[model samples]
Target: MAVLETPGAAGEPEIEVQIRGLMLDPVTNMPIVVLKEVGSDVVLPIWVGVFEANAIALELEKTETPRPMTHDLLRNLAKGLNATVRKVVVSDLRADTFFASIWMEQGGETVVIDARPSDAIALALRWDCPIYVSSKVMRHTRQNNAETAANVGADDLKRWLENLNEDDTGQYKM
Candidate 1:
């Protein structure tokens, strides 16, 4: 999976990938973040927990929930502290496990808070913050690319595309 970062992520992280879609697993009842390369046609799938997935999905759909969720609370807390989530860094990938940090700015100082990639991403979505994964993490993800492709066969992709019998609109509609 590519680290998230928009123009605001950090010093302008290259926008190599864009979130293509979010899929819910039947068994886990959780959501998967789908990313597609900017030009080339490649997709990365990252599974996420239900609570965090809901946070990201809500942002994509531009839907406001009845109340602020945990992520929202974190965002407010950041603001109250005069801090801003500058960017989220996806820093590590080992044994298929990923790690991350939330970079915040306050009092002209930058702070990096350790976090799980999934949680950082969820919070990033809620705070309208940019996401950044290190180049090293991207390289590691590349190492697993082949295995990822083999697991998701062409037949599987066809089946998935067929299931999405709707327009590829801008809205995430997750």
Candidate 2:
């Protein structure tokens, strides 16, 4: 089970979210991993590189590769070392870059490893663990969306991101 710390402020709870889908950004043509808060309308989109996106897509579709992929190898290594992946957290956003932490347990000891949001998410899927996002990051995303909306002279970006449905995430190609 995933354990999250209580927020210090009201309306600032650590949100448990799921991978809504993965799609390509129309403008930048970058891969975006869309995460939606459980039982809520809040959404967070993190743009990622092509290779990382490919790793996520492969797992998302449950495609089997003849050889173990990097994420697969990591999962195997953890198991071999008697480590269990507890959870993954999208812990922070800084200068438009998002950060994540991979929480693991080994021999009654807890370990936290810093990672990119994309990598952490990929590992989370492999481990079948819960994913979380800090309320502060969600607030920052909303603020950034507003700023982007204003600069774009329309709320298209925000609207488009918030309104993405499962069908909108077509097969992500390399």
Candidate 3:
């Protein structure tokens, strides 16, 4: 079973990870965003809702929306306030749910906001901020990865994405 640490979880230092990709879980038919440690096989899969998944996928695919989406609005608001999104940290995993904090810098002061991992991830992508996973979270996820063999080859993932229909992305609202 996978271990998940709650917020304020005391353990190892956080390890930086990059967004590997966004794909649908074959079994559950739910969208999952994959994160991978640099130069390592460690991977974390966070299942997300349909709407948030679409937001992340749009950013990943670099598809420009006709107007600002929620994430884009957040990015624009930050810019207007002269704040920068320093980074987003996937801080914990509790009860199979991941939590995150979005760190922002304004006027030399840093502010951290509690956010769902999916929203944090979407905003992070728009702001071009770095993404990190707490080491405890990673260690727990990695252990689970070993047992379930959750790693998917790049080719397989690419093929899965390629086969998606336009409507599969979900409809967008203004």
Model 1 poorest 10 in a row by lDDT: 161-170
Candidate lDDT (C-alpha), each: 0.65, 0.84, 0.76
Q: Residue 32, candidate 3: how far off, in angstroms?
A: 0.6
Q: By the lDDT metric, which is better: model 1 or model 3?
A: 3
What does candidate 3's lDDT look like per residue over 1-174, in tens digits?
222233333454566677766767778888877776766656677888999988988888789999999999999999999999988889988888898989899999989899999999999999887788888787787676555443664445434443444454333211
lDDT per residue for candidate 2 within 1-174, as digits (tens), equals 122565422335577888888998888989999998888766899999898999999998899999999999999999999999988888888787898889899999989899999999999999999898978887788888789889987898777877877578875434
Q: How many backbone clashes are present in model 2?
A: 0
TM-score of 1: 0.72
Cα error, candidate 1, residue 163 (Å) = 13
Provide the clashing-pair count of each candidate structure. Answer: 1, 0, 0
Candidate 1: Cα lDDT at 66: 90
Against the true structure, whose lDDT is highest?
2
Best by TM-score: 2
Pairs in steric clash, model 3: none
In the predicted model 1, the residue pairs found to clash are 4-131
- Each model's TM-score, in the order given? 0.72, 0.89, 0.78
